[model samples]
Target: MPREYRMMTEAPPPLEITDLTTTFVSRNRRTEVVRGVSFTVRRGETMMLLGESGSGKSVTARSIMRLYGPSAEIGGSVKLLGRELLDLAEPQLRAIRGAQIALVPQDPTGALDPLRRIGSQLTEVLAAHGVERVRGAARRRAEELLALVGIPDPKRVADSYPHELSGGMRQRAVIAIAVSCDPQVLIADEPTTALDVTVQAQILELIAELQQRLGMAVLMVTHDVGVAAEFGGRVGVMYAGKLVEEGPARQVLSSPRHPYTAGLLDSLPTPGIARGALRSIVGSPPSVGAFPLGCAFAARCPHARRSCGEADPPLVAVGADRVAACPVVNTEAAVA
Candidate 1:
């Protein structure tokens, strides 16, 4: 296993989230999108929040960054290198947003300003964060950043507008902006959603390489199991706003302790599995604020019991460095 794949035992992780929750308050109703999700990302390690759409993985990532507006109520703790972020004032957060912490948003085209040149955008971030002050110096550093992210012709790409670059190049430019100040933590939410397979692989590889070199912790939110496997660090399986299971990527994916995790793996297309023979989970995930009283996944779980529907299951120890919120699986494991 690569060093990045192993859990770092550092005293203070680069990022630590505890019992995080996000609730959207509208005129008539409140929707809790993220419910008590928690995890830690050690330096130089990638912690993947893997789940299907509407599973709240992306919401959880945003909660860590405190990205929601006043209508969204965020709770619990988000600590970057032991500093609490939830209570930080807007100015304080503004100082940290792109310097100590950065985000590679899902849509790179939307992330970059269309009217501005890519080089100008990069220089803007550099100047805003005080990384470079002089106009010429900032422009040169922006070009260096473009080159750092593997753009072959940094000068040309920097000079081009957002619409002028290819999708892959745009995504690379977004990453360059994100890492311009050498943040301690990088949050990549669905970084490969709209990219081609080849570009997706390249982006993932570039992020991994950058993580290894910069010693930065990565929080990667994606619905693709392949991305989780490729990153190969820690994996947290989320469903209906809660973490259903979490463990080392290889262990959880290979020997899933939660039925939802198993269902996701089974749905993948492998060489041994025939064409059009995927085994999908029975029901769709529940919408926010409409979750059942008990286990959110009980309705679709194969091993659900009468008690499973009575209350929300708490995450329990399933093995070394692993936890799952499923009593049936825990009971079976204990018996075995």
Candidate 2:
């Protein structure tokens, strides 16, 4: 059997999130962010959560790792290889974090401690995760991780603090830390947002290469359509904390079945398009806890009708291995 087929058939997926919901409570008020989101990422596969900022993409990713403090709330299931993470005690969760499931945060500078050297930080993760029991072995493994991430002169870079490295270098260090223990699942949230075009491409390529080499199930969260297009596995387009469209990345990004998805693709800067002629989605996304009565995107969607505001549209099959929550498109598809 092909590797992909066998990975799916032989065992459970590395990550499975079903009906995931996230809410925040402050001063006796509640605001929900992610709502009933569901997806599974198999071994060696990539699943992208794409949306405009504040569409709850980051919240969904962070919720999987249960990174929130006491003020936040989480519901639904987050499972890794059939082990539920949402209900796991902190001690047990600690064992899985960094060792089984790891996250590459958006801001590399913020993610890394300013006071710590890169090598020490890497070694610390190894020690905490019990990947290297000995002090010397842990230090050596830290350098090896740096080298694995394409950092030349790993020893020198490892000795340097985060501020001493360039943005791209720091990002590479973060990726190295995320993969140091060979995690079964990896969550990279906007990994290339702060870099220049050249560095961005390099970082993305490094991530893709590492995913292939390590056979990790990756959940890459980003707002860039180009990024989604490049990471061609599956894509979930989120809006107002709900997944509006999902399918094979090529299908969802190339020929969208949702108005929001179509509008997003249309807004991109294509070659030869004049700067002022770029199309844009007119309205702003709704804030959490302030969504419209029914379909959250209906107000901004061109094809929206009165009925669209009457009830939340369920994600229905629009194509092979695809689902979308747009009544107008679904109706048109049915008629056609």
Candidate 3:
């Protein structure tokens, strides 16, 4: 187990997002990609936003960092250590971005500048954040970051271009840059998606170690249940931009509440389950531009009722620190 996996309850929440919505406008039409998603990340803890592709996982993350372009219309509140993030000016936002809240994006290859050396890119971030005053100091700090992220021969690797490094090394270098300022919050959007299984484990372990050392809150967005189970303290299941289910990782994995969450767990490959016996969700995720009238997952949910198609269910408390947005749970509890 990585160091970050060691549970600690004394730390305060480093990041909080409340009723956040992100919409994209085009041709006088607007489509919401993130729909009032809210969650918190305590220092030294990892909260995973777990869902399949197009489930608004990445959109929610980008909204936190305010990385969406001009066409994007955002609402709601994001706070880093109780400071409002959405209302900040561009320059202020930039100052806080890498220093307070950093993002390790999904694609490392696309994130780095091909024309620049890795060391220079890392130094630019440090310089921009005012972490290092002199060019020589920035270079030294860059080399230290590379070594901290487990890159071999930090000096040699720092001088190399992004393209010269392997996929895993590039990803590590990106993580190094993201954590250079020792941010209070780290949002990793599918950081291990492009890597092989071995590399994935290594990267996850690295993140866990850094989180523990820095006491930073981590918002890890991933589609893999296994990864969430392994790395997340709390797991949130999103559907059509809404958080459908959330709870302690162990409870959620053992007994998922939402139909969609259950279906996702059922689809995971298990040791005892025969190779051909794997289950899959019945339908594709709904499009953001044209979501259904009621529950976004009602169209595909096996347990959906008449009320499920009428209105979106509110997230109701199911247990201590557990919430699920499903009418079935309420109906079942009422009947029982």
Best-performing candidate as measured by lDDT = 1
Model 2 Cα shift for residue 224 (angstroms): 0.4
What are the root-mean-square deviations of the candidates from the true structure over C-alphas? 3.9, 2.6, 4.8
**Model 2 scores what on Cα lDDT?**
0.93
Write one digit per residue (lDDT tens) for candidate 2, span 41-130.
999999999999999999999999999967789999999998999888888988998999999999999999999999999999988887
TM-score of each: 0.96, 0.96, 0.94
Cα distance off (Å), candidate 3, residue 170: 0.1
- What TM-score does structure 2 among the candidates reach? 0.96
Model 3 residue 128 distance off true place after TM-score fit, in angstroms: 0.9
Question: How many steric clashes between backbone atoms does each model show?
Answer: 0, 0, 0
lDDT of each: 0.93, 0.93, 0.91
| Deviation (Å) of 321 in candidate 3 | 0.6
For candidate 2, the C-alpha RMSD (Å) to the true structure equals 2.6
Candidate 3 residues 1-336, lDDT tens each?
566755453444688899999999889799988999998888788899999889999999999989986888889989888888888889899889999999999999999999999999999999898899699989999999999999989999899999899999999999999999999999999999879999999999999999988988999999999999999699999988999999899999998878989999999888999989999999788877789899999888888889888999988888889999987965676588
Instruction: Please give the ranking of all candidate structures by lDDT, highest first, separated by commas.
Output: 1, 2, 3
Which regions of candidate 2 are displaced past 4 Å? 1-9
Consecutive 10-residue window with the lowest summed lDDT within model 2? 4-13
